[model samples]
Target: MKLAAATPAAAQVKADELGQIPVLMYHRIMVKPQQSLDRSTTELYDELTRLAKDGYVPITAAQFVSGRIDVPAGKHPVVLTFDDSTPGHFGLDAQGNPKPDTAVGVIERVAHENPGFRPVATFYLNKDLFGMDELQAAAGLKWLVQHGYEVANHTMSHPDLSHLTKDQVHKEISGMEDEIVKMTGAHTTTFAYPFGVAPHKPAWAEKLDGSYAFQGIFLAGWRPSVSPFDGKFDRWAIDRVRSEGKVKEDDCKQFCSTAWLDYLDKHPDERYTSDGDPNTVTFPNVLEDRLAKPYRAWARVY
Candidate 1:
């Protein structure tokens, strides 16, 4: 007797479930860093390899925020977010190419070697982009967006938003968006709070006259983020786990990569599994009543 093939709806139902996405955060990707935020190139590459081997696909923070994960079925989705516009994060060489040791270079190389792996990441940039020449910075920023990478705001000077006045907060947030538009001719819709400090008021995310707005705002986290499709999703206060080695001041519980990855290892059912098809949304029948508005309409209940 021949076995029946799975229909699209059945396949989607099988893929349907609430996914816990780990938005891995990184600072400077370099060797011999002066701060805890700095991660060595080898460490970076190793992490990327591990993610690829574990069937993780890199998606933009915007995509994750929009609840539109489009990775292949059976694969998990992860967002690689690089904070700060440091030289080591992303810069060009004398040949006008991505520096090999830079975050961009390493991601490009890793994706090239790993066929299904995508060389995409969200770079939360400040006014000073990689400390490159103005002309070079503009070209580089353009290149980043054109290559499927996201350029987002990390404030103009990485200020602590909690203490600033509303006007000051606007300057810190909208000012950076304006500058990014001027440099790259693109508008950034996402933001990351500097020093992991969120504003006291909701105005920080609102768009006033002549001020910019953000669809998603990130905070430093020691844990994985809930699926945007979950009822508990909070776009303004998204959490991200850091990708760094051991450090004294850092809280490894939910802030480090190993902790979260290990957590997922122990609780495999809580992890996000794609339906291998981007057009259809899938989730477990248990979460049928908790699906968000955007996904509720099309999501298949397994």
Candidate 2:
């Protein structure tokens, strides 16, 4: 069912299109949560289930940056971003189905169980290419793109860009683009900085002299992103919240996905709530100052 952003029923749902949206970053899925970045199969499954039950729908990173979101009215858009492209992130078994314990596997299961939960996500690729061989990586890339998943450049070597020279930085970014072109005959328009940190110049990641370009470059930050239509939005350094449970260290106890999601639930007006439409941005009149000038024509106030 299609829904317009300015529908009268939007009031009941408190559609705040100008509010923040969670862009959750994940690294790997494993049998054991040995590392802070690792999520067990059960943890991944349960977390996604919680998101679905809370009225969130998965959208690709490209869609989020391009502002092409179109989830049902009253349902918010959440971006599921898996970095490192680890072996446990995606794979196929004998029947060519996603391995049940992998990130994609868990997401597929959740979407199958929830009526409006879509099995879509963005995978950031590094040189290792999901720890698969050339043939396998090629097939995996094809499968992911064919299945509505977004594959983005995450540099050839996942080095901290801050330590690399200008030439090295360009190579790191362009090398990944070359791989995507070699495998898929196409290149990704979006990118994520390795370690979620850009080089000293930063602009190098956003573009490489005309050889490549990106619409958005994500960062490893500790908060939900401002709406793309908001004045505070930055395509070059969009903030992404790390996906993890409570932890007292690194301020994860308060800034992690689990904690922030809880806070958003209690303070519902702070998070972005869809008006079931993509063509317009709906929010209260008081937030008028927060809307970006370019998107002002699309803004609708209650």
Candidate 3:
């Protein structure tokens, strides 16, 4: 019997020509489930394990928005996002480290176990920071930023933007940005609409000042997000699919993580694929002009 050969570093995997990426939306990670938003620890671990086995590399929201995906060659890019600052989402242990079983803890652990798995994620938080004690909230926010994870805005109190006045909208969006800056000394550039509802009257995206301007805004969609490289990509209204085990009241068709993963498996060409080089992006030649200005310099014809 012959022994199996070692995998080569330069071997290329089948790549997604259009650069379509998936931004998975997750809420609470709890041991004991409560409500539809809460997911169990076993489920969370299983999902991460599946992603690793399927060649899905985690990227931060900032990287996805900027079109600067720098994962290893042959790995697909995916964004793992946690909404709200619930206690089950994140917390500190007795030694002041990230507690295991929480979303952040589980993510970190997965990355540790999987050598090439990137330990990056974006947390859209409200006024509350992981529902930790008031004194620990600031430190926790700072810790997330220092560790390369993104800390983004989710409004001051998670109110429905569609129902609020312009002034009220300003307070809700800018208030959280101000609080985050004051606490962690980090500026937030991304926002996720509460309840997936955009403002009905004055558009929030158009009225934002330089201090609180958002580069990307996310919605709670039960579908995959378009590539930032695509001309139809909307930075102000980016779509995200929910991460759950079963379809709930608000979930759309193919809402769960497994369904979306299976969808990608069925249509591998629609998923984002690396050219094995971070310096270059590979896509169809016809879309050459559609590449963002920042990424055009290194865009390669597939």
Give lDDT tens digits, candidate 1, residues 1-302: 21223346546435644778999999887766676777898889999998898888999998888767888877889999999888888887889778998999999999988989989999998888898878888999998998999999998899888888988888877888888999877677788889878878865555656657678888887778988878888998898999864444577755589777877868767888887666555776666666677665567654
Instruction: lDDT winner between 1 and 2, please give it.
Output: 2
Report the lDDT of model 1 for residue 249: 57
TM-scores across all candidates?
0.92, 0.96, 0.90
Instruction: Please give the RMSD of candidate 1 to the true structure.
Output: 3.9
The C-alpha RMSD in Å for every predicted model, in order, reads: 3.9, 2.9, 6.0
Task: State the displacement of the C-alpha of residue 232, model 3, in Å, after optimal TM-score superposition.
Answer: 1.1
Q: What is candidate 3's CA lDDT for residue 191?
A: 86
Ten residues in a row with the worst lDDT in model 3? 1-10
Clashing pairs in 3: none
Whole-model Cα lDDT of every candidate shown, in order? 0.81, 0.89, 0.79
Candidate 2 stretches with Cα past 4 Å from truth are 1-5
lDDT of 3 at 279: 57
lDDT of model 2 at position 29:
88
Using TM-score as the measure, the top candidate is 2
lDDT for position 142 in model 1? 90
Give the CA lDDT, 0 to 100, for residue 253 in model 1: 54
lDDT of 2: 0.89
Ranking by lDDT: 2, 1, 3
